[model samples]
Each structure stands twice: as C-alpha cells, then as structure tokens.
Target: MAPTIPGFGYRRVPVADDVALNVAVAGSGSPIVLLHGFPQTHLMWRHVAADLAADHTVICPDLRGYGASDKPSETDGTAYAKRTMAADIIALAHALGHERFALAGHDRGALVAIRAALDHPEAITHLASLDVLPTLDMWDVMHGTGAAVGFHLYLMAQPPGLPEQMIHATADAFFGHFLDVWTNNPQAIPAEIRAAYLSASRAAVPSIVADYRASAGIDVEHDRADRDAGNQLRMPVTVLQQDWGAALGFDAAALWNAWAPGLRHTTVSCGHFMAEEAPADVVKAIRDLLARC
Candidate 1:
C-alpha cells in the first residue's frame, strides 16, 4: 500500500496511448510536479509536497510501473525509457489542467525530469534535480573500483531475463538494500514507508527491471543524441547532489553546466534520498529555483 500523504488526495491521470499514472495531488496554486525515484513511490514526497502545498499545487506520481499505477509487461526493453516516462509526466500535467509547470525529480525520476526538460522545454518552466547527474554523465563518472556503489545499476543493466529472475527470487532483500544504504537518517523514511517500497518493488519486478534496463540502452542513446546536438535544459535549473564527482575524479557542477546553462549547483550533505533525508533543504532550493524563474 502507498503511504498516506497529508492533505493530498490520490487520483489516476491518463497520459499516453494507454498509460495513466497514479498521482497524489494537493494545493491549488501554480502546479509543481514532483516525480519519485526507484524502490519507492510518490509516498517519498509526503513531507516535501505538504510543505510546498502552501504555495503551489503539487502533483506527485508513482512512475507507471510502481505504486498503484498500471504496469504493463514489456515486449521491447524500451517500455520504461526516460523519454517515455517524461512524456507520461508531460501529459499528466496537461491533463491536470496545467499546460506548463515547474518540475523536480529525485534519482531515477531526475532522469525522467531531465528528459522532459530537454524534450519539452516549453512545458517545464523551472526544474530541479536532486542527488543525480544526467544519464551520460552518470555513466561517465562511474568507472573502475569506486563505482561499486552503483553495482545494482550494472546488475540491472543486464539483458532482461537474469536480472528479473534473480531480483524476483529475493525482491525484498534486493529492493530493501537501497532503502538501507542510501539514507543517513533511518527515521526520515519510517518503517511503514520502507515496507511500502519493498511491497511495491516486489510486486512489479519485470516492469521495474525494464525501467532500469532502458537506461543502459535507449536512455543513453537519447541523452547522447541531445548532447551531440547541443541540447541543454533551457530553464532555470537547480541541482543538489552529493559530490560523488570528488571521489570519482570528475567535476559534477562543471558536467551539469554542460547541460544546464543557467545552473545553480550545490553539493548537499544529505543521503541519496534527499527529499526524505533533507527535505527542508530540498524545499528551500526548489523555492529559490522557482523564485528565479
């Protein structure tokens, strides 16, 4: 079950030929869509969404395959490509009565937001990405022994069959590992939310794996094409990420600058789950981003 977000009501918003996402919405001002990451649902934004609800209409959605959203079995591995996921977000906002909106994403959702901002710049007025680099930069920075932190990225990047089989065999343990390792504060994500993540992850094994697999294949191609074509996120963009580039011998801000021309980049001390682990900071950064826009 998805955790209850205070002052937020749940609804399903249709956004594609056949895809509609389970979204939690609140407030009544200018729209701000918050996309959740892997191993978790829109529930992760419980606090942040509530905080923003005072001034913005917040739309939090479980990216198709997770939470109560419809999960279709994949025929081709591109089912959960960020491009497709981004379209789902765009259409969701449109259907919600917002032709354009401010967008922010954490982790995998950040990948989707990146694609959305690049693919439909006019639709995303202001953008924020928490604890992530773009797809191409993500691959470029993770190399050699230090990249072991992202072992799951490599494991899930494998051709569909085995990654699916192995993970389904121990879904809770596999998904729970992230909830365990990625956070500095255990209390931020309560026991109930953690259980919700494990349950949702276990129930959607194949689609979730397809989501990961697409990043290594089609997602990379899209990011590379954009980079080669001199595409950048043409919006007021703020990025709050752990300085993983310091350890990996790359410049995270400089890399993001290559993509976000008017970028306000900062390295936060929070864990990967910044929305939960450091929500106040996330909210402040988002407010600042939106203010400038």
Candidate 2:
C-alpha cells in the first residue's frame, strides 16, 4: 500500500473518460495541487502535503501512471507529455471543486506545473517548481561532462522498445539508483517507504519510460515553441532547486529569469528530492508563493 498522511483520504479522480488519477486530499481551504516526479507517486509529498493541509486543501495525485493510477499501454509518447499531464492536473483540481489554485511540482511534476503555468496561466494563482529547469533549457545546458549526469535522459529518449526492456529487466535497481543518490539524508525516506516506491516504480516501467521519452521529444518541442513566442509565467513563481548549475557550469537563476521575471529562485542545500529531503522549506516556499498571489 502507498504511504498516507494522517487526515488525507484517497480518491480515484476522473480526469478523462479513460484516465483517472489516484489522489490524496485533505484540509479545507484554498486548493493547492502537488505533483510528484519520476519513479515516485504522490506519496513523495507525504510530509509537505500534510503540513500544507493546516491552512490549504492539499491534493497529491499519482500522475496517471506511477502508482495505483491508470497506466495506458499506448506509446505515441504525446499522452505522457507535460502538456497533457498538466491538463490532467488542471482537470483534476476542477473536478475537486477548485477553479483557480496554487500548483507545485517536484522533478517530473515540476515540468507539468511549468506547462500548466504556461498553458493555463489564468487558472494558476501561484506556481512553485522544485528542482528542475524547463525542458529546452535542461537539454541546452547538458554538454560533454555536464551531460554525463543525464545518462538516463538520453537512454529513455531513444525510441521505446529497448529502454523498456532494459529497465523492466531490473526495475528495482534502476529506480533505486535515484532514491539512493538523490537524497543527502537517508532518513528522509525510511525503509518501508522506499520499498513502496520501488515496488510502484517497478510496476510502472512502461509509463515511466514513455513519460521521460516525451520529455526528450515532444516536451522539448512544446518548450521551444513557448520560448520563441516570449511566453513567461504570469503568476508569482518560486523555484527551489539544488545549485546544479553551480556544479554543472550554468546559471540556473539566469535561465529561469529569462522565463520568469521577478522569479524567487533559490539554491537549496539538499538533495534532488527537496520535498522529501527538506519538507519544511518546500512547504514554506509554497506558502510564501501563495501568499503573494
């Protein structure tokens, strides 16, 4: 079973006729939707979501394929695109009686929130993107040694067949690599929760592959089209990320400033999984962003 926050209740929320998100909801104020990253489900937000619930209705959902959510076998890759995933989030909040809400995404989910802020600007009251760059910028920054970290980005970007076969061949190790390396504090994810993530990710090999593959192809295309058009995030935007650019030789804040004027970008001292690694900071950053809106 997926880990749960004390007061939250589970719901299978229908975003479309064939797709429904397994969501956890709690509290009863302005709604704020939290999206999880790769190799994880909404369960990643256990602490942060629970904290936010004190003053906000927090909705954490498995992004269509990672947990007990619907995982369609189709692989055109467009279905897993951030644009489509963003729509799922918007539709989910609407279904739960939220017309305009704060949206936060960590890792893969950050990409979706970025898309949501770009595509449906009016619907998002505030936006918090944790530990990621835009798709185009992400690809643009990786070069030579800098590109070494994104081995999986190139791996899954290849046309489907092989990536799925290889990962499925040894799913736990593949998923566990991130859980192992991405966190500075092993205590952030205890034994049982890590097991849950590993199990869910192993079962979600296909959709996870398709989701990353979309980033390499369609997600980049969507991002380029926006950058070319001079689109910017209209809402109050806060980006909390590890200073990857410092180590990787790029200006993370400058790249984000190009897309988000007056952006509240900060270099967090934590591992890649900020929500879990630094839940208090993540919660405060999100709360601060919403207060601005």
Candidate 3:
C-alpha cells in the first residue's frame, strides 16, 4: 500500500462547462499546481506533492479526462487538446484565487503545463516539466527502432474508437506493463497507488485515447504554430528527464532548448516515473528551480 501522508484533502472544483474536478490540495504558501502524465492521476505526485506541501501550497488535480475529474465527451477533438486542458488549469487556479502561480507537470501533465505557459505566459510564474519532449520535437524525432520505444504513442494516436477498444481489450496488461517497466524502482509505487492507477486508467480509456490522438493531430499543429511564431515560455523553465539520447539516439536537451530559451535541463538516473522513483531528488530539483525563479 502507498503510505498515507497527512494533511492532504480532496476538493471538487468547477472548470469549463460546469465540469467538476476532484483535486487534492494541501499546504499553505504560494500555490503550485501539479499535473500528472498519461495513464496516471494526481496520485503520481502523492510523494512529491506532499513534500512540497510542507512548504508550499500544492494543488494536484486530475486532468479533465483522467482520474476523478469530469471526463467530458470529446467534442470536435478540441476538447482534449492541451490548449483546452491548459485553460482548465488556468481556470482551476483562478477559481482557487491564484491569479499567478508556479506550475509543474509530469508525463502528459508536463505537456499541459508547457502549453499553459506558452498560451498563458502572463498567468504562470515558473514552469517545470518532467520527462517529456515538446510535442513537435517528439513527433519529428520518432523514426525506425527509436520510434518503437514509444509504440503506445503511435497506437493511441490512431483514429477514434479503435485505440480505446484495443487497450480496453487488454486493460490490465496495457497499464500494468508501464507500471512494471517505466519505473527504475518498482517498490516506489505501492499496491494501493498501483491499483489506483490501474482503476482510473481502466475507467478513462476513451478519454485517455482521445488525449493522445489530439497530440498527434491538433496539438502538433499548435506546437508548430508556436515554433513558427517564435513563441516560447517566458517563465523560468526547468526540465528533468531521463537522458534518452544515450539510449535513444537523440539530443534531448537540444530539443528542449529550442522551445525554452530560459531553460535549465537536468537528467536524472530514474526511469520515466521520476517523481515516485526518486522523490527526494525530484523535490530538490523543484526547490532549486523555485529558488532560481
């Protein structure tokens, strides 16, 4: 079981279209919104958020289509676009009375946070992205055997109902494979947290697939537009990622540098689930980034 941390409580807040999000909020200082990656919920930040909450007001929310949040039907594919999801975060923050705040996201959340910073630069003070390349870079770089590593991305990006149906057909194996493979430290995610992730992912299959599909389509277009317009994140940015170049034959830092001019990039020894696998190191990185900001 995931060890319980005290002082954390869940709240349901309204975002767009009267959709309510079940967010886990804790601590009592300047606000920091935490976003989770694909196939995971706010629970991914259970360790890091609790630690940050000791000194900062931390708000970890399940993104619109994930976790305990409202899984609204994907209307016109724009619904799951990071632009809309980022807006949801901005609205969620505003609802909590924070006109401006720091933001950090892991996996898919990292993408959403970056989108928020680019689209709503005036609303974010500092930004941190964990373990993801910008959408355009990601799409441009995938090729041959290197591309095979992210097979799920391609599979999930396929049209409509198929990806969801395929994944749901083998839901446990689909989600469990990542839970077992993505972490450097398997024990980092306890039984309860693992079970929670599996349950939430199984429940949000269609919405989750819609999210990845958006990345392959509209999200890529948005990223290209931003690159063409020379739009980069204005806030101080920190990116912590596993060095994919050493194994995957790409310059990870160079790609991030193209998007974030004021960027601090660090490679951690942990696998994809850095926050859970290496909480102390992740916490220190956040503190160092916050200090610089």
Kindly list the per-residue Cα lDDT of model 1 for residues 67-89, writing each as its tens digit: 88888777876679999899999
Residue 266 in candidate 1, Cα distance off native in Å: 1.0
Task: List model 3 lDDT by residue over 66-113, tens digit each.
Answer: 988999888798999999999999999999999999999998999999
TM-score of predicted model 3?
0.97
Report the lDDT tens digits of candidate 2 across residue range 235-270: 899999997788999999999999998599987899
**Where is model 1 more than 4 Å wrong at Cα?**
none
TM-score per prediction, in order, is: 0.98, 0.98, 0.97
lDDT per model vs. reference: 0.90, 0.90, 0.90
Instruction: Supply the TM-score for candidate 2.
Output: 0.98
Q: What shift in Å separates residue 149 of candidate 2 from its native position after superposition? A: 0.9
lDDT of 1 at 289: 93
RMSD in Å for candidate 2, one decimal?
A: 1.0
